[model samples]
Target: MRFLGSRGLIAAAALAGTLVTAPAAEAAPASCAVADAMVSAGNYWLEHGTNLAAPDWQNATFHVGNLATVRTTGVSNHKTLPWAKANGYLLQNDPKRPFFPDFEAAGEAYLDLYTYFHPDPPILADLRSRISAEVASVAQGHDDYWNYVDALNMAMPSFARIGLLDQDESILDTMQKLFHHAEKEIGLFDEATGLWYRDARYVGTGTFWARGNGWALAALTKVLQVLPASDPRRPEYLRVFTKMANTLRFTQRGDGFWNSDLLRPWHYGGPESSGTAMFTYGLAWGVNAGILDAARFRPVVDRGWKALSTKALRPDGRFGYVQPVGAAPGPAKPADTAAYGVGAFLLTGQQVANLTPGC
Candidate 1:
C-alpha cells in the first residue's frame, strides 16, 4: 500500500507489540476483524486507486477523501491531512465543483477530517473567512432542505478548532436560527409520531430520513465538541443532540445499520452506509464526551464498525452501499459513489480508533 505517512503503520506496529501485554479490556474484540478488513481495503485504494502523480487537484479529491478515510480508520499517518488541506485551494478552484453554494460544506468536511492531525493556522483562517462570508449571505434566504443544515453544522467544528469562536459568533447565531427553522418550518418535530419530519413539505407522513437525521446528529455532535460548557447555546445543542440520538437509537436495525427511511424499513430495502457511518460517529462521540452511556452505546459502535467494515467496504477499498447524492432518501444505486460518504465513514473510523487501545 502507498504510504501516506509512517505514523499509522508505526502506531499499528506498536499496538501489535503491546497487544501481547495489554489487558483484556485493551485487546480488540474478535469481531473487530472488520477493522482489519477496513485497513486492508483502505490500503488497497491508496496504493492502486489513488492517482498520487496527478497534476490536477480536483481530480485528486477522491484520493484525498480516501486518504482521510485511511487516517480515520487508523491505517495511515497524519501527513495526508496536511496534504489534503494544502490541496483545498485547488478543490475550491475547480470550476466544475465551485466552492460557493452548498459545496462550501464539502470544504468544511475536508477541513474537519484533517483537523485531528494537521492544525494549520493559515488554512483554518482562510476556511473560516470563506465559511463566515457564505453563512452570512446564505442565512438571509429561506432553505427548506435538511441536508443544507447538515452541511453547515458539519463545518462549524472546523471554525471552532481554529479559535474562530469569537469571530464566528454571527455564524453560530445563524446556525441556531437555521436549526430553529428546521425545527419549526421543516417539521423537524412531528406531533403524531413524536419524530422529526424528513422535510418541510412532508408532514407526519414522511419518515425521518436517515441521512438527514445523520446530518443533524453529526452537526450537533460537532458543534458540541468545540462549544464551551459556558456558551449560552451549549445546553440547547445538547438537548437537541440527546433527542436526536434517542429517536434514532431505537430505529437501528438488528444487523446494526440504519435503513434509508428510518421509520419505514420496507421503503428502502437495505442498510445505508452514509447514514450508518454518521450515526456511529455521532454515537461514539456522545459516549466519549460522557453525554451518553458508554456501556449502552459501545455495542452500537461495534456493530456499526462491523457492518461498515464488512458490508460496505470492498477488498479494493471502494466503499459500496453508499446512497448516491440526492435531496432525499431513496434506493441506493449500484453506480453511486460519493466523496461525502467516504468522509462520514472516516469520521466514524476516527472515533473508533480513539476508543481502541494502541491504535
Candidate 2:
C-alpha cells in the first residue's frame, strides 16, 4: 500500500529538488501548469469514478480523449462504464480477445497518476490486479501484429513498480520476458538505413509509424530507467534507443514535429500532434536520463512544446489533431480525435515541466 517509505520519500524529495532548482525565469508556460494539475485531476476521476462506456466524452470511462476531458474538467457523468469495462473488458462481439491495447494505455495512465498522488492502497491494488490479470491472460497464447508489443509496454511499468514494492522476483522476470518478446517481435535493424524498423519485417511500402515508434522509444526509456546499470540487456536497449532517436531526429520537420509518415512527408500530410508529443516526451526523457545530448535535442523539444502549446491546445486546454487509433499512418483528418492524443499532450507537458526550469 505504502510503496514510498522513508527511503522512497527521501529519494522523491531529492528528485523534486533537482526539478524545482531550475531557474524561475525558465518556468513553464501557464497552460503547461496542468502537468502537475493531472495529479489532482486524475484523483478526482478515480474517486468520483464513472462507468467506462457511457459514450459521454466527459466521463473517465471513455478512451484517451475522454481521459483528457476529465483531466481538464473534473466533472464527469456517471453513465461512463465501470473501470473494468472502460479499461478494455472483453466485448461479447470480440469475446475471445480483450482490448489489450486500450488496457495498456489505461494502465500507463493509472500508474503515472499513482506515482504522483500515491492513491489509496486499495485503489492501487485493484488497478494492479486488473492490469496484471489482463496481461497474464493476453500473454498466455496470444499473438497479433502489434497487440503483444502494446501489452508488453503497458505491463512493464506496473510490474517493475510492483517488484520494487514487494521484492517480487516473479514480477521482475515477467517484465524481462515481455521486453525480450517485444524486442524480437517489433524491433528490426536496417543495415542500409542504420535505423530501426517499427517491426521485425518491412513491408515494401512500410515506413515507421510515428506513434508506434514513439511508443517503442518511450517504452525503452522506461525499461532502462528501472533496469540495473550492470544488466547485460541494458546496453543493448540503449543502443537500439539511440539508433531510433537518431532516425527520429533526422525525420523531424522544420516546424518541430514529425510527419504523419516518418519516412516521407509527400505521401502523408503535415506534422501530427500525437506522434510529435510522444517523440518530444521520449527525447526529453532521454536527455533527462543522460542517455542523449540535451543540447542536440533541446531545439527539437522547444519547437515541439511551442507547437503543442500554441497549435494543438484549444483555449479550454483540449488537445486536437491527434491521429485516431490505427496500426499505421493514415490520412490525418480533422475528425480523427483520440484520447491517446490528449494523453500524449499531457505526457509532453509533464516532461516540459521538468525541462523548463532546468533549461
Candidate 3:
C-alpha cells in the first residue's frame, strides 16, 4: 500500500505488528466468511476494548457501525446494542446541547435500533426532539451550519432516517438543503474529480483527503437510502454520488487502499484503513442500491475488501492503519487504529456481505 513518506512502511511495521503477517492457513474459504470474521473482529474490540458505550463521536461512530455489522449478519453482540438502549443513546454531551454534530452522531444507532423493532421506539423521544430542533434551525436559513465535511457523517443520516421514519418530508428537505449549502455553496467539492476538500482551507489546495471524501461518500449513500425516490431532491443526491463514485474509481492504490490524501498521494502517504473502509462501504452500498454500475464498481469493492482483509484486519480482530482524530489530511500509520476506523471497517464489511456473490 503506497504510503506517503520514506518512513511509511517502517512506521507501519513499527506500530502494527499484526500487518506484518497473514492469518492462519485455516482461514475461512468464502468471501462471506471473511466478512463475518471482520465483523467478529469489530465485536471483539467493542466488547473488550475501551470503545464500548462511550458517548463521544469516536465511540459513537463505532457503535453506529456496530449496528450495521450486527444487522447485516443477523448476529448481535450482546454488549453493544442493548447497552446503547439501556443508556438511552447518549454520551458525554447533554441532550440540552444538541447542535454539535459529533454529539448527535450516536442517534444513528438509536434510530436504526428503533426501526428494527415494530412500534415507535420510546428511545426516540429524546433524540427526536433534539434533532427536530436542529433541523428547524437549519430550515430557518442556517444552511451553512454543517461547515465541516465531518459533520455530514456525524449527522446527515440521523436527519434523513428521522424524516423517512416519520414520513416528514420537510425534515428531509431541510437536510438536503443544508448539505448542498455546505458542500456546493462553500465550494468544498472539486468538480473535476468528484471529491471534497476537508474544509475551507484545504479548498485552496484542492486536496482530496481520503477520510474527508469518505465521509461525504458514505453520508451521501445514507441520504440516498432514506430519501424517497419520488422526492424532488433525490436526483441531485444521486448526481453527486455518481461523481464521487467515478472519481474514487481511478484514485485507489493498486493494493486497494487509499492514502490519507486521496489526490496528493505523497501528502501523509500511507495506507489508512479507516478511509479505505469507508470508501469500500460507500461503493458497495452504491452498487447494492443500483445507483452505481455493478460492472464498474464491483471490482473496486473486491480489491478494497481484499486490501482490508489482507492488510488491515489482524488475526486477533484489531483493525489497523487508522489515522488518529484530525480535521484534515495528515499522516497515519498502519498500527494507528481508532474507534472510528473500526466503525468504517465494519460498515464496509456489512455492505460487502450484502453484495451478491460473483458480481
Candidate 4:
C-alpha cells in the first residue's frame, strides 16, 4: 500500500482531486522539474533490484523506457543501467525460443547502454548476436510476426535502435517490413479513425482503446527517432503518426486525460493515467519533431501534464489510475497502478520537459 513512501503527499493529492482542466488554468511548475521529480520518486517506489530480469515484455518495456527517461532528464546515472548490465543484457527468450517481439524488448535498453557508455561493448554482444541470428532464421517473409499493436512498441524500436547502432541499414529494412505487414496485412490500422485496433476484436467497431493506440503511436515515434530520413519508409511512418495525433487531439477529455476507450468515452469513462501518459509522451515528441502543429498540440500536452501531475500523482510521487494489464478497455479505478503505467508517466514527463513554448 505504501507505494511511494509518501502517504502524506498521496493524501493531499487525493483531496485536491483532478488538478488541471481546460479553458484557463493556473501556471504550474516547470515541465522538466515536474518530470524529474516524478522519475526520481518512481525509481524510489519501484525498487527493482540490480539483477532482476523478466522474460515478458511488460517488465522489459518499462525498464527500456525508464532508461530513456533517465537519460532525457539528466538524472545522475541510476541503477537501471547497472541492473541491465548485471543481467547480461539478455531478454526473456533464449535462442531456443521461437521468434517473438516481446522477447526483443530488452534489447532497447542494452543498445542504449552500449551506445551511451562504450561502442561495440561486450555488454551487448549477447543481445546483438541473438537478435541477428533470430532475424536471419525466423523473419523469412514477415509472416504476421508482429500481430498485436503492443508488440510494435515491444520490438520495432529495438530493431531500429540496434540497426542504427550497427550501421546495418538492411536490418532496419527488416523492421519496416514487419511493421508494414502488421499495419497493412493484419487489419490493425483502422483507416477511418487514424487509430489502431488492439487486435481483431475491436477492428471495425468504433472502439479505440487509448492505451492500445498509445503503444502504436509511441512505437512509431521511437522508430522515427532513430530512423534515417533517407529510408523510403519514413514518409509513410510520418503520415501515420500525424493522422493518429490528429485523431487523438479530438478525443482528449475535457479534464486533459483520455478515457480508456477512445471513441466510446463512456466505456471505462474515467481518468486512465497510462494511456494519457503515453499519448502525452507521443504528442509531445511529435511537437518536438515538428511533425505535429505545435500551436494546436501544445495545449493538449499542457492539459495532460497537469492532469498527470495533479490527479494521477500522489504528493509523494506514486502514479495512480493505471489500468491493470489488459488487451482491451475495461474498468480502471483511480487507485489501480502498475510498473508499465509508471514507465508511461516517466516517458511523458521526459518529452514534456523537452518542449519549447510557442510554435
Candidate 5:
C-alpha cells in the first residue's frame, strides 16, 4: 500500500450556518470514521461521475485520488486494471496542445497503476514517448512549458515520479528547471506572503486564490511523496511546502474551510471544498510524513476534515461547493460540484484515515 502516499474530528457534525461560530467537538474516534466516509463519497462518485478511464484533467485527477482510496480500503483492482486497459494506458496528449500539461495529466494516475499493480510494460509506453519528448524539450533550453500554476500539480508530479522510476536525476533536475521558470523567472510565487499567483497576470495583484495555493501545495507534497529522502533536492521542495503550510495555518476560516479568496475572504466567503480538501490533504501528508509538527498542523487538518465531511459533502455523497474552473477567486455554491473537487476529497480522506486519534 506504500505505492504512494490521516485525520480526525468526526466531521460528521458539520454545518452550523455556512460559518460556525466555533467548530463542533471533533476528534479522530477509534472507528476511523474518515475512511468509511471516504468510501461512501467514493461510491457516490463512481455511480454518478464519468467512467474512470475517461481521458481528461477531471477524470485523470479523480483516478489519482480514487486509486489512493482503493489502497486505503484494500478494494480490489477490478476498476483500475480494466479502465487502464480500455484506455490503452495512454496519457492524455491532445493534438492541439501537444505538450499541454492537462492533456498529459493522466500520467500521474498511469504511473500509480504501474507502481501499485505492477502492470505490464506497455502501461508505460505513452509516458515514455510523450514525457521523453518533454524532457528533450526542456533540455533544449525550453523552460516556459509550465505557464500556469495548476501545471505544477497537473504535470510536474508525474515528471518527478518518472524521474525516480527511471533513476534519471537529469529528468528530476529538468523538473526543477521548469519549476524555476514558473516560480522565479515568471514571478508566480510570492515568497513575501508564502503563496503563489495563479499565473503571470495575478502577480503583484494582491490576490491570493485558495484553489491556486491548494494546487501548488498539493504538487509540492506529491513531489516529496515520490522523492527519495536522501536526495539533495528534497529540502528545497520541503521548504516550499512548510512555508505555505504555515501561511495557510493562519488564514483558515473558523468554519474549517478556506474562502476562495484567501486573504480577502469577503470576495467569495463561504466553504469551498476543492481548496479546503486539497489543503487538508497536504497538511495531513506533511504531518504524517513528520516534516510538519503535529501539534501545530493537526488542528488545521482536523478543522478541514470536519468542514468537508460535514458541510461540503451532501448526505447523498455529492461533494459540493467547488468553484468552477477559473484563474481567480469565484463563488462556489452548495450545488456546485465536479469530479476534480470530489477527487480532492478522496485524496484528503486517504490521508485523514492515517491519523492516529489526532495525536
Candidate 6:
C-alpha cells in the first residue's frame, strides 16, 4: 500500500531511513568554512526539502537557521523566499493541538523573512491574526500552552519577533506572562541549577536533559535579541541567560560536546549535536552581543563551535550525533542527524563568524 504524507508527499517517517551519515573523517574539510560550509548544508537541505522530518519544528528550524546564513554569507535567498511563498506565508498549523507552540515553530522563519528579505503584509498576515487572538484570549483567561521548555524555544521568539515588528506591547506583555508562568507556576525551571527540566517528568529526578536546557537558552537568546531596549523584563531574561551560560561553561565536556544528560552524564552520555549547537549559538551570540564576558564565555563558544563544526559536521554538511525527537536525554550516535540540528549549526555558525571573522 502506498501512503502519502502532507500534500500527498511520502510520509515524513520514510525519511528516517534516508538520514545518510558519514564517517567522522568523511565530508569534513581540514579547515571548515563557517558561513560557506553551513550554507552549503542549508542549500543541500533546501534543495532536497522532501527528504526531511516533521514540518512543524524540524524543517521550520532549518528555515530559520538557513535564512540566518543567507543574511551573513550573502548567499542567494532563492530557496526560502520561494518556499515561503508556496506555503502561503502563514504559520504552520497543528489542528490537533491548535494552540501548541510546536506548530508555531515555523513562524520564526516567517518573521525572519518579514524582517530581512520581504516586509510584505502577506508574510505576516497569519502571524498577526494568531498572535492577536492569543493576546485577547490571554487577557480573558490563563493558558498554559507553553508548559514545556521546548515550547519556549519554539514559540517565545516568534512572539518577541512579532512584537518587535508591530510594536505591540500587549503581545510582548503576554509573552512575558506565559514565560514566567512556565518558570514559577509550572515550576520547570530551577534558578539554582540554571537549568530547566524538559517537563514535569524530570522535575525531581535530578536529570537535566542537555538539549532541553539548550532549547531554553536559545529561546532566551532569541527573545532578548529582539526585545526592545526599554523593555522592563530585560533583567530577568538576562539573569537566566547568564546563569545558564555560567552553568554550561562548567558542564561542557573536554572534547567540546555536551553530554545528553548534562548533570548526570551516565544517563546516556555521549556527544549530542543539537544541544551543543544550541549552546554554541547562545554563547556565541552572548559574547558577540556583549552580554557575556569574552574572558569567560569566549573559550566555551570557541570550544563548542570547534567540536560542532569539526566533529558533528560531515564535510558535505550532514551533521552527526543529533538526538532524535524526544523529551529526555538519550544516546546520540555519530550517525544520527536531523535538519533541526543543521539549523542549530547554522545559528551557531553565523554568531561564531561574527566573533571570529575567518572561522
Q: Could you estimate the TM-score for every candidate?
A: 0.72, 0.69, 0.86, 0.84, 0.89, 0.88
RMSD list, candidates in order = 7.3, 7.0, 11.2, 10.2, 9.1, 10.4
What's the lDDT for all of these models?
0.59, 0.54, 0.74, 0.72, 0.80, 0.79
Which portions of model 4 miss their true places by more than 4 Å? 1-32, 48-55, 94-97, 118-120, 356-359
Question: Which regions of candidate 5 deviate over 4 angstroms?
Answer: 1-30, 50-53
Best model number under lDDT:
5
Worst 10 residues of 1 by lDDT: 18-27
User: What stretches of model 3 exceed 4 Å from their correct place?
Assistant: 1-31, 91-98, 117-120, 356-359
Q: How many residue pairs clash in each candidate at the backbone level?
A: 1, 10, 6, 2, 6, 2
* Candidate 6 accuracy as TM-score: 0.88
Kindly list the per-residue Cα lDDT of model 5 for residues 274-340, writing each as its tens digit.
Answer: 9999999999999998989999999999999999999898888888898987889999999888888
State the displacement of the C-alpha of residue 105, model 2, in Å, after optimal TM-score superposition: 3.5
Q: Which stretches of candidate 2 lie over 4 Å from their true place?
A: 1-95, 98-101, 126-149, 185-205, 334-336
Model 4 weakest lDDT span, ten residues long:
1-10
Candidate 4 per-residue C-alpha lDDT over 265-326 given as tens digits, one digit per residue, 9 for 90 to 100 = 76889899888989999999988889888999999999998898888887766778888889
Q: How many backbone clashes does candidate 5 have?
A: 6
- Give the true-structure RMSD of model 1: 7.3
Model 2 per-residue lDDT tens digits across residues 1-114: 112333334433442233233221222333544443333333333444334343221222123323333333332332223443454432122234443443434444444334
**Tens-digit per-residue lDDT, 139-220, candidate 3:** 6777776878888988898888777667677887878788887778988877877888887887768677888888888888
| Model 2 Cα shift for residue 275 (angstroms) | 0.6
Give model 5's TM-score versus the native structure. Answer: 0.89
Ranking by lDDT: 5, 6, 3, 4, 1, 2
The ten-residue window of minimal lDDT in model 2 covers 55-64
lDDT of 6 by residue, 165-260 (tens): 666789889998889888888888897788998887777777898889989999999988766566798889989999999999999999999999
Q: lDDT (0-100) at residue 102 of candidate 2?
A: 37
lDDT of 2: 0.54
